[model samples]
Target: MHPQIFGVLLLALAPAQVFCIFNRRTWGARTASSPLARFDGPASLVVIHTTNTNPCSIPSMCKSVVRDLQIKNIASNSSDIAYNFLIGCCSGVYEGTGWDYKAPISHNYKDPAIHVALIGKFDESAVPTHMSQSLRALISESQLRNKLKNSFTITEHKSNSSTRKLMVKNFLQGFAEYKEQVNDLLLPEQRAATSTTAKPAVSVPSSKPSSPTTFSTASDRKATFATSTSKPTTAKNQFFYT
Candidate 1:
């Protein structure tokens, strides 16, 4: 083929090329005991979360933490890791359930949404610049791959329980920085809304605790969902137990 033709072909294929994300296989994720549920359509929302645990900056450590998370979820009777993706402090993105499956927390959202968790406790520490950049890149890649809608809205994960306070402070700070950084990618209406505290336009049910268990350690906290109450927004939406 002519050089110009070859150059054009490369340009055309660039959008589909892999980004910095580490897929489940590459991260050594355990196979789900049962097949995960598929999304009905492209995700329209992006939910951000924190691991409430130590951060990992290297690929080996990040992969171990990711695998540990998967194990914990399975032991809790979860189908797999709850988030669709997880970002390490410096290890780039690690795929959780990936783009096709519905996250275990999906029931909390009115529309399909992908969950991304930052692999570290953020209550006191600022989100690392590298982690933030990796997250933004992952979101961009998601749009390019059609895993996320171009107008997808981003929201932070909130815990209804008071015991879960460790994530609130810095998580909010990190979220603000992230929202601003991705302003160009958000829906126009969302971008126009200047208030970081503004409520989500769409309403979803709030997860109700069933046989709730509380842990003194932030890392060990867990809660099971049983029922939900109709809520009028996703912003500051409380879904996690702690």
Candidate 2:
């Protein structure tokens, strides 16, 4: 092969090789207390979720949040963190149960779906561009690795009957915004359906809103955590969308 042609090919492929993914070790994730089941085949669906907590952007803080979540999951009797991958607000992607494992949040052991949780409460705000880009990159990486199907469909996690009434509207609002933001990343059929379908109208409660919470970016050193004084909202709150 000609040296010049080889150099040109490498330059063309460089961007595709630049994705950053933080592995379990990077975040000091714990071993699952219980045995984890492996996925039988590549996932065909990607379920989006929000942590419903404060967003973390800095690498150190994001790692701490992920570690805490893992510990919380284990304490709740879950084998490991429920989601397959988590996209940090600014810190990039953090691996959860990973590609080959069947996350406990899935409908069943045989369910062909990859669950991805975005760090932070997105119910009332748009997902930050950095986080969305990381998510897109992660999805592309999953497809390249054969862990996710090229034609995978994306959907937001919906709560069950008990919480659905209180949470669905909030989640749908975020999902609508998210869907629009990532439209270009979707498959042709998915994009067509989204464009044709009208987004549902969400009614905002007349009650006084809670005080606004601030999020830290990659440059910020201090972080503010959301307080429990605020009313509970949707996503990854005990229900896993199948």
Candidate 3:
């Protein structure tokens, strides 16, 4: 390689190396159940899904759910990755972001729209036993964490599973209501305030505060569904568990 190009490459690597050194000062892992998933708000809705639909391929039933339930804020970059939090039907917490209460473009996301995935097609079918119950628990806790003193809304792609999990307000931790949200994507306690927090600490360029997650492919989505419909046959089953 050319010496000049290699020198520039060395400079590029320096920041990433430094970031690895300092990341322990940032996000802490606080379990998948933190209310810091969305920022403070009188959240309008929590989006719920019943499948991992790769709409571009074999028409997925969840495609309609994504279309109807996903919020089309101009700032979210793409229509994909639209949910504030996605809980797979297998009770796994997959992708999530945002809890912003301020400017949609500049601030972090804090949407109360807790989206859950059925891990398979649910528009015309049934969700797995574990998924159906796990999402109820999460959403129920979310109601209390967000301090929804009054009635709040929980949304799903379909009108089935009429969630009684809202009863979670009666089952919340003693102090979840008192805790304030930090930035909105994660708990303040979970943020890299000190060591010992177990966040998935990935290194990236300094230009971005958070790194981008890779998108699921059509084949991957199909495989996710296939695994859900039958016994585990793919690697995604690991992700679907709590």
Candidate 4:
């Protein structure tokens, strides 16, 4: 093999490295309390969530928030933390379960999805734009690293049946705009599922064939009529013609 050709091939085949945006140590993730296992590449969906009671926007407050959650997760008899990532309004992003990790956090049934959560109560307070964008960037980079299809899903914890308690209040409104940025990354099946359930297309019927109007004069306007005892036919209305 030619040296130039070999060098070119190596460059083309090498996997691109992904960098973390948030400072893990800054957010006080000293170490994993328990052993952490890595998951296989390219998660199908990225689930957004927040703490149940705390909506702390300040970075200082987030240290305790992460600490407390870790302790609680361990107390619950679960290994390490439940989420793959955590975002604070001021803290950027903190490593939770870490990338390529299958968080014990369940979505739909016991299915594990890539999970990212804001540290504060987004339901009451708005999610900072920086926090939102950082989350998007992180997911986008991860998708590239894992060689995932362009299509992926953005969801909320409340969307998960088992983790309703981890709901990030009022986050959907902002999430709408965030989803658009990564819309192209969504898989074909995801788009097909959306189209299948979309509102039925509206159909307008052509005007009915016109009927000529004619009137007959009554007998000197004194014609008497006997009431007929007949049942009227009930026909369902059709709006369009095939």
Q: How do the residues 4-72 of candidate 3 rate in per-residue lDDT, one tens digit apiece?
A: 111000001111210000010011212222122234654544444443443222223333333433333
Q: Candidate 4: which stretches are off by over 4 Å?
A: 1-35, 107-112, 159-242
How do the predictions measure up, each by TM-score?
0.61, 0.60, 0.33, 0.54
Best by lDDT: 1
Predictions ranked by TM-score, top down?
Answer: 1, 2, 4, 3
Q: Summarize candidate 4's per-residue lDDT along 183-234 as a digit string, tens digits.
A: 2333444433222222222232221212121112222123221111121122
Q: For model 4, what is the error of residue 219's alpha carbon versus the real structure, in angstroms, after optimal superposition?
A: 99
Relative to the true structure, candidate 2 has a C-alpha RMSD (angstroms) of 15.6
Worst 10 residues of 1 by lDDT: 2-11
The local lDDT score (0 to 100) that residue 53 gets in candidate 2 is: 61
* Worst window of 10 by summed lDDT in candidate 3: 2-11
Whole-model Cα lDDT of every candidate shown, in order:
0.55, 0.54, 0.29, 0.46
What is the lDDT ranking, best to worst?
1, 2, 4, 3
Q: Give me candidate 1's TM-score against the actual structure.
A: 0.61
lDDT tens digits, residue span 58-109, model 1: 7678889999998998899888888888888753567788777877866555
Best by TM-score: 1
Off by over 4 Å in 2: 1-17, 108-110, 159-242
